[model samples]
Target: MAQDIGRVHVIRHLIEKSRDRKIKKMIEKMMPILLVLAASVCIATTFGILFTLVFETFEFFQRVSIIEYFFGTEWYPFSSGNPSFGVLPLIMGTLKVTIIAMIVAVPFGLAVAIYLSEYASGRTRKFIKPVLEILAGVPTIVYGFFALTFVTPILQIFIPSLKLFNAISPGIVVGMMILPSIISLSEDAMNAVPNAIREGALALGATKLEVALKVVLPAAFSGIIASIVLAISRAIGETMIVTLAGGAMPSFDFSVTGSIQTMTAYIVQVSSGDAGYGTVIYYSMYAVGFTLFIFTLLMNFIAHKISKRFREEY
Candidate 1:
């Protein structure tokens, strides 16, 4: 009887093992289908957005002259008499803030990235990296309010010409908001440089700083440029900080201390129910969004090209 019981137990264990193998095979077969479904969702969403923007922008152009909209300098879409729909001022505002943000973020971000990748000890990097990432994760609305209440006031102390709502404060805050992207991505790129290269340079009597600047930096150039481009795209799409702190006054002036309205800010204003649905002003929002979309797409394309062109093979 004991021998018969052992035989039964062995048979049951073999059956269970076979069933587990079948389950594992089934899961492996399902993974590709699941991944394809996820990719399809993303593709569908992108097309949906593109179609919406195109349809609405077409409607806007039917009512407003495309030539005037593109080349006209005035942008008073809410005028009581004749509302102008020129996009130049909005474009100028967007570019001004973006330029200022790049100016502030690029140098500082690259410097910090170099420091973290080349000089920081493992423990120090662990602490500092998380802090920078946390700063990045902080809500943009908070940054907007910080710029409006804090930075603007501080700037006013130095430059009495600074307005309560101006591009400078928001530009600086946006720069701070995008710092983590530049720092984290650039540092990762720098770290990806082979240790063998560093050793080889050092063996030839190259100093650490020299190796980092001349050798590692050139090797990581593509990644750093891609990171900067991504940051520029983020700065362009930033809405709350520019809307709240950069003011709602659209202007062609490039002065950093002047109040300006970006394409996103104008979209916010139009979408805030101030313009009735189906009004030309409401349709103008789509036009602005489509324009913003084009700018971001161009930036991404440039990043891809630069990454591909300058990428270094291991």
Candidate 2:
């Protein structure tokens, strides 16, 4: 009887071990599928939101002509009187901020990246990198306040034509906000350049600046372009800075010194408390959002193309 009991215990232990091994193997086999599902979640969510926006936008356009939505010159959806739904001024406003931010961010960001990658020592790079990228972590509202309270006053002195809530201050602050992304991504790309390439350039008597600008930058150009496009996308979508620093005036003008409102700012304005749900004005928000979605989607596609177009494994 005792021998039979001992044999039964041994069998139970073996069975438990076998079960555990099978479970582990099953999980291992499912790992890739699980990762793919996780990736697909983002795509699914994006499509879902896009579908919702399109459905709502189509409904809005049914009430207002598509031509008026796309080409009309005025946007007064909340006006008590006749309300117009023209998106051109909003598009222009978004373009103005984006262009100014790019103009400020591109050269400055590339310069900083080059200096950090080529000239800065270990300690300097360590100290400066975090401090610079820290700006990215700061809230957009805080930057908005800085733009309005701090930068605007200074600009008013230099360009007296600049209004209290002009586009220039917000654009400049957005550029500063965008700087961290450009620097970090550009630095990563520059660092990824083969050290052998740098060595060859130096062996040929090229200066550090020459190697950076001519050799490393050209090699990392695709990544730099991706970073710039992504930065511009962020600038176009930014809300708090532009809403606070840029006045609520939507105009067809492009002057940075003048007050203007971006698409994002207008969306924020409408969604916050312009009208009740199911109203034409309320539906206009979705139309604007859909337009923004298409713009950003195109930008993402371009960035993807640029990145995939070239590969240097060495």
Candidate 3:
């Protein structure tokens, strides 16, 4: 009887050991699969948002004529008979704001970045960097008001045709809005450059300016250019400032003195008033927004490619 009990205990112990090993193996295998599942969920979420935009845009296009949507000269939704859906004017307006913003932001932001990275002392940098970033944190509506009430009047002094909601005012304000992004990003790139590289240039008797302009700047060119592109994207997608300060006229004229409508401004225009969802006017908003999203996405892709291509390995 004692021998029988011993044999039974041995069998139970072997079964328990096998079960534990199988459970351990299963857990180990599942961990990697779980990680993959988490990553897939994140990617799916991103694609889902994009898919929502695309699907709505498709619905919009099904109702509206593509020719009218893209090439129509006027964008008066509530005006009398057949509404003209030419999106060219809005595209032109968006380009005007983006170009003006780049013009304003690039030079000043780069200069600030150069100063902060190459010239400023640690103490000065500590003081100035935060202040510059504070510009980024300021509400866009405040900038819009500033442009409307302050900058527009100032611009009118130099150019008489500048209106209350001219492209110039909003463009400048949008530039200001993106300036911090450019400055902060460019400064980070410049700072990332190896100290040894700077020191080597200096050792060769190059002036600080020469080292900065020739060596450091070129080395960090990818990052600087990426920053500029990002700034342009921000300018292109700006909503509140352009909507508030820019005139809603969808004119094809490239003049900064006139009020022009941007894509975002148009979106705001369509979404704000009495346009009900599922209507042609309301659906048009999705189409326009999808176009704008594509533009920004392309810009981001270009920036990413440039950054990846030119990334320096230390």
Candidate 4:
């Protein structure tokens, strides 16, 4: 019995030593390659997407002038005589929808985050957060269908001219789609505020609301803003909901009641139909996609910069 016990101890020590050495070597070997691999993957993916968009966009621009694509008000590439290829209308439509979405999402998302982080009990927060995440996990196509089938009809009650697929419903749904992202991020930021700060605020005789609004919120402002910017970028890049719900007609008007097409919607419309390669219509999709890609990229870069500059210290 004594001999066996000694052998087991020796074996366990050997195994522990082996594991420690293995883990240390793994970390040492991986440390350098980690950043390189990350950068390489990012560049590769960016280049792949950018290259395809640029070449296709270049082909598109050959048929359509840069000026026309940028400043043109009408977008009817399929129409006959005097077809206008102005991309401004589509840009305006995208902006209108995004603005509406931001308006709907930001306040509610931030409020929910504050409530969850500052007010909710542990049990309530645990339950509510999963439910919120589930909201995000719902397939966007379902939301698109809901917008088309339900939201538009509801809007039609107030606005007779509202089409089967309009910006209002989809924009609202897109806002809902992005709400969980914003809330989750913002709550994380809020929760990162040190307990000492909260206690100090309470020590100063400030109410919970006052402490949260004036102290904790300010401390976490950078993270909250970063979350908002990221959410905006997400809204701009959203495709399925906008495509399935927003009507596929690119227009220059800023009216929410009117049917308008986003950059993503336009791409989907073109890609859905049969257009042979090397055709103007085919190239046009690339050009629109390139434009959308650049727009989203710019937003992402800005958001990244903001996040880096304002990321929480601890």
Candidate 5:
């Protein structure tokens, strides 16, 4: 009877193993199809948005001169009588804010990342990193209001020339908004540097700073640059902060502290039920949006290229 029971148990174990193998094989067969489906969804969404933007933008160009849209310095598309469709001023404003944001974010963010990656104790890092990254979850509208009600007031004390509503105020707030992304990405990259490399450098009596700045930084350079590029892309696409703190004047000017309207701000202005449907001004918003999409797409492409080129292999 014991032998009969052992035989039955052995047969059941074989059956279970065979069933597991069959299940594994089935999953393997479906894996490629599942992955293809996932990739197709992403591709389809991208093409869908591109098609929408292109169709509307082509319609916009039919109502406005492409050359004027690209080269004209002033933007007064909503003027009661002689509405001009030039978009350069909006472009200038966007660039001004983005440039200022990078100026504030890059050096300071990188410095924080380095300190967190190389110097901080494990307990300190664990405590501080979450606190710092919590900034990412902060609503952009809050940042916009803070820029208007807080940062601007502080800046006015030091630089009395600063305007109540200007590019610099929003730019600073956008920089703060982008800070978590920069620090998180850069620290991840720096942390990915092998312990062996640090040990190898230290074996030669190199100082910790030297090891960090020279060995770790070079290895992590690609990720660091990618972070900065992403931060720039993030800044350029921002709307609420720029719309609230950055003034609505779409005038092409080089003054950092002056009132200017970004592409995003202009889009908001037009979309606020100000422009009638099917009007030239309404179409111009699509054109401006397309321009912004292309600009951000180009920046992301460049970042992808940079990170791809310099990706370090272990």
Candidate 6:
């Protein structure tokens, strides 16, 4: 009876091992299919958005003159009799805010990144990095309100000409909003430089700052530029901050103190029940959105080209 029990246990063990192998093989086969399905979903969603934007924008151009829309300086889509659809003013407003944001974000972010990557102790970096990332996660609407209420008031004391709802305040807030992207990406890029290069520079009598600036900065140049480009894209696409703080008036003026409207702000305004469905104003939103998309796409393309051209291999 004991011999018979041992034989039976051996047989059951072999069966369980075979069943485990079959389950493992089934999982391996299913993984590829699951990954492909996920990719397909993303691709389908992108195409759906593109199709919607293109069709509506094409219809808008049929009704409105494309030449006027592109080149005209005025943008009064709500005008009772002759609603001018010149997109130039909106473009200028966007550029003004973007330029201001870049000016504020680049220097401060780069400085923080350099310090974090090259100078900070591990414990300090661990604490500060999370704080910076948390800043990035703060709701943009909160930034807008902060710009509208707090920053604007502070600026008014320094620049009496600054309007309550102007480009400068929101631009500064937007800069703060995008600071984490610059800091995190630039720091990562700087850290990716080989320690051997730093050691060699140090052995040659270079100071810590010198090695960081000359060796690491050059090696990470592409990444820093890419981060800046990404920040610019984020600034361009930001809506709530500009809409709430930058005012609703679309102006051709480039003054930072004056009120102006960005493309995203205009979209929000029209979509807020002011423009009826299927109206020209409604359709114009798609045109502006497409234009914004083109700008961001162009920036991304440039970033990709720059990274490819200047990427350094270890």
lDDT of 2 at 40: 100
Clashes of 4: 2
* lDDT measured at residue 138 in model 1 versus the true structure, 0 to 100: 98
Report the lDDT tens digits of candidate 5 across residue range 178-266.
99999999998898888999999999999999998999999999989998998899899999999999999977779988798999998
Question: Residue by residue across 92-175, what tens digits does model 6's lDDT show?
Answer: 999999999999999999999999998999999999988997998999999999999999999999999988889999999999
TM-score of each: 0.88, 0.88, 0.85, 0.85, 0.86, 0.88
TM-score of candidate 2 against the unseen true structure:
0.88
lDDT of 1: 0.92
Pairs that collide in candidate 6 are: none
Least accurate 10 contiguous residues by lDDT in model 5: 305-314
Candidate 1 local lDDT, 1-314, one digit each (tens): 99999999999999999999999999999999999999999999999999999999999999999999999999999898999999999999999899989999999999999999998899998899889979988999999999999999999999999998898999999999999999998988898899999999999999989999999999999989999999999999999999999988998876889899999999998888578878899899999999999999999899888767756465
Better of 4 and 5 by lDDT: 5
On lDDT, who's better, 5 or 6?
6
The alpha-carbon deviation from the true structure for residue 37 of candidate 2, after best TM-score superposition, in angstroms, is: 6.6
lDDT of 5: 0.91
Q: Is candidate 2 or candidate 4 better by lDDT?
A: 2
Q: Which stretches of candidate 4 lie over 4 Å from their true place?
A: 1-42
- Model 2 segments beyond 4 Å from truth? 1-40, 312-314
Query: lDDT scores for all predictions?
Result: 0.92, 0.89, 0.89, 0.87, 0.91, 0.92
Better of 3 and 5 by TM-score: 5
The TM-score, computed over Cα atoms with residue i paired to residue i, of candidate 1 is 0.88
At residue 129, candidate 6 shows an lDDT of: 88
True lDDT of residue 113, candidate 5: 95
Q: How do the residues 44-95 of candidate 2 rate in per-residue lDDT, one tens digit apiece? A: 9988998899999988988999999899999877777898999998998889
